[model samples]
Target: MPSRSRYDVVIVGGGHNGLVAAAYLAGAGRRVAVLERLDAAGGAAVSGTPFPGVAARLSRFAYLVSLLPRRVVQDLGLRLELRRRPFASYTPTVRDGAPTGLLVGDGEERVRTSFTRLTGDEREYVAWRAFYARTGRLAGRVFPTLTEPLPSRAELRARVADEAVWSAVFERPLGETVEETFADDLVRGVVLTDALIGTFAHAHDPSLAQNRCFLYHVIGQGSGDWDVPVGGMGAVTGALLEAAVAAGAEIATGHEVTGIATDGRGAEVAWRTDAGEGVLGAGTVLVNASPSELARLLGEPGPPAPEGSQLKVNMLLRRLPALRDPAVDPREAFAGTFHVAEGYAELETAYREAAAGRPPTVPPSEVYCHSLTDPTILSPALAADGYHTMTLFGLHTPARLFSGDPADRERTRERLVADALAALDTHLAEPLADCLAVDADGRPCLEVRTPGDLEDELRLPGGHIFHGDLAFPHRAEEGEPADQAERWGVATGHRNVLLCGAGAVRGGGVSGVGGHNAAMAVLGR
Candidate 1:
């Protein structure tokens, strides 16, 4: 049945952010409704058993959780858990006859030994740690501000309080910073990769979108760690759903919100459910949709269509692949982020090619074996069989490259996947394809998500994962509600409707900053 035709707040899009907002608002004793277009919630933070006759549930889209705030978890009393990976990353040079490249974490001696090859001395490694130490401090200062009223950029820079740190990160191009800081080209490329993950810009793009993206990737929980959720990505969302329901939030799945209007008086939402169309009246509307989608719902012009530049590949490996470096076990190499063909110079080359209307010749991507860190993701049968799930996030392959006719798009996807797999082969002792788990159909258990695929699946405008290019977290002006400094930074130019999704300020990842901020904005907290 439909909700009471009215609510204190109607949250459109039952993504994790929406659910977070619903929980906060409902917990405050407000009547709330969360309408999800899909039959279930979670958005990209979902898990599913993609392979038939196989019981392993793969975290379909997003595979890691880092930005979710500890405060939110504690405040909501969520039982969600996240497991840390001891090995941070291993970069495998695709060059033949070259060693297995570099791996960070595991042991300080091994990591320092790897760094000596790149740094030639401890000076460079010292500099690397110093650089992140400064950024880590900055992350600590900035993360707490995310859910509060917008702070001026000057205030934020002042809070960090170091001119050199501010200039190197916020002012100088990230490319220049990495080049100046790291002596090794591959090491520099590894640092810059964080800047380019899903961003389509070069490290030196004048817009500094790369810098912002890099900052977000590095500054999670003030530790710069991207941890694996205890179960899968679904665990985070499942907990959010649980918290919201416990707080008296009504969630209606399969309810696709189609229209929204807001005035000084209140907000109205129209949706298409399985039964029929319905309109909801609410004192306020919290939108978990992308900014472009929200703009369309509000009958306004959307931003320039954003584009997603990543190709994600998910596979169930029959067993861990053999590593080229005999000294390092496959368990340690694959546990954290595994990089392939991601040397700095190569990254630049791939970015230039993709920018020049082509997919990367050597497709730069990262892979991680999730089961290595958390065995709970696998069923007992699969666990006994030594099967593990791996996720690959391919960078710089823009959506525009797949913009041709249908057949051409498919061809591009196939070529990209083939090239990516071929690159991953360079670091393995044996071909990775040989280790792929066979599905019921006798085919390899694999799935590739192109930028177009993300668009179709998640309604991510242009498949842009962060909704759009990340904007600076603060408003330009200081201390003025009229100037947007006093708003929770969730305001959508609508008095009573606000954005609580990746498009909102400080929004992205599985973080509920937008959700928390929106609720705070409504509650005058």
Candidate 2:
């Protein structure tokens, strides 16, 4: 090994979380450095020129941004340039020869009725809101104390006192809860779909009721608005990178970290950069990659097995689909997020198929046309000239490709894209085939993602987006022992090393809480 040059801290993976941690540590007058495997800072939250003249988000994976803590943004001074707009989701159902379903209002309305479909009654919307308010207050009592080392015995007792709040909330399955709460099937279905996203659980499954509460815990309620960052989701990370740089943090990209060397007091990280072998030493090391990726960086036998599974697909479209909704103005369609699951059974069946490692014949998908919301992110005037760039997220798709062969993977990708387009057609009735933008050679338009590609290329464990399950074991829930929180946050059996990725805490989305909390722990603050 070369001579070790020490710093106050070292963060692994330039994903938003790692960047967030580095920024906070640097803000506190500590010398910090961030190491990213990819050439860019943002991992999934990025926009790039994959093809010449085509700049789009790599996965367009994350669409909504309500759960993120505003305190982090304000502390980092990121609110100045960050642009956001209120967007609501639409769940369409064909009734009396016309489509109709509940349109969840932004913020508290969204949170209150998140599980409305499962409740089966509109009246349950109020109950759902009540549940969120109760749970959030309980969470506040615990989460602030969870950012550091394990809580003391007294702290654990105080946090658990709030556990009684969830007693009535977790009494029923999410589907049952919704049915008992709402008289509307469409509303129940919409809420159930939200609970099942990125997981294998069915709506009727026991112990899944808490999943709805879990989802609400992360959502922003006070403002009650689900907004997309201006420019693109990439802009969020770009702003974070800028903030880190301003805070005196150094970032090195395209430098893949191969291994982590650690002792009780400090650590040495090895990476392969263009400049040949590079090593950095520091008293603290934070890993922002998925749990599995982090384990791989530590070599085999690193950490526990990953929890749950995830699959994502992104498409570059030639034009926007003409959906049948008077409320869906062409401009607002992209401004809002759309869900394809019509009912609870539909969402349940999709999750069942995904759990069985088989692709659903009609997969539930979430489609976002960024050009519809922000024209600036696309090539010149794509949104203005009646052309828009779109991305489709097929939730709960098979993590394993049907066939091990490369040809089979390609076929599966086509099937998934076709299913998403077909689902979009049900609501839009637009001929997606008419507008085709192909390569110079004039081939059919293509969708860009494969299960095999995500697992084999992106190194995602079972293609899970959050890198791990967001269940209690992985999440920072109250009543848990202090040692458990430490294991969940930074310490992973390796001394002087830590974890700061989505897998560590909130377990997905662009929220930098995990990163910020990890930095606080390492700094002994």
Best by TM-score: 1
lDDT of 1 by residue, 1-525 (tens): 345999999999999999999999999999999999999999999999888888888999998987888989999999898988989988765334657467799677878887766446777667777887888888888877776777778788887788887887788888888877878777887888888878998878889989889988888887889999989999999999999999999999999999998784688899997788889899989899898999899899988999888999999999999987766788988998888888888888999999999989999999999999888889999999999999999999999999989999999999999999999887788999999998888888899898888888789999999898987777767756762314778877777888888988889888998898888888883
For model 1, state the Cα shift of residue 448 in Å: 1.1
Q: Candidate 2: TM-score?
A: 0.83
Can you tell me which runs of candidate 1 are displaced by over 4 Å? Answer: 94-97, 117-120, 483-486
lDDT of each: 0.86, 0.63
Error of 2 at 477 (Å): 9.3
- Each candidate: RMSD to true structure? 1.6, 4.5
lDDT per residue for candidate 2 within 1-525, as digits (tens), equals 222367778888888888888889888888887877676778777765444445444335465565556778888988423445545665666666765444554566554454354344456667556645664665555444434445544554456475454443334565665676555656566556656555656766775633643444334533334565677768888889999989988888877888887776778888787778778888878888777776677775655644333345454567666567654454455556577764667777777776776778787876666665566766565444565666666666655644567677777777877786777677775666665455444654444654455556556676666675564423345555344326345657665667787766544666787787677666663
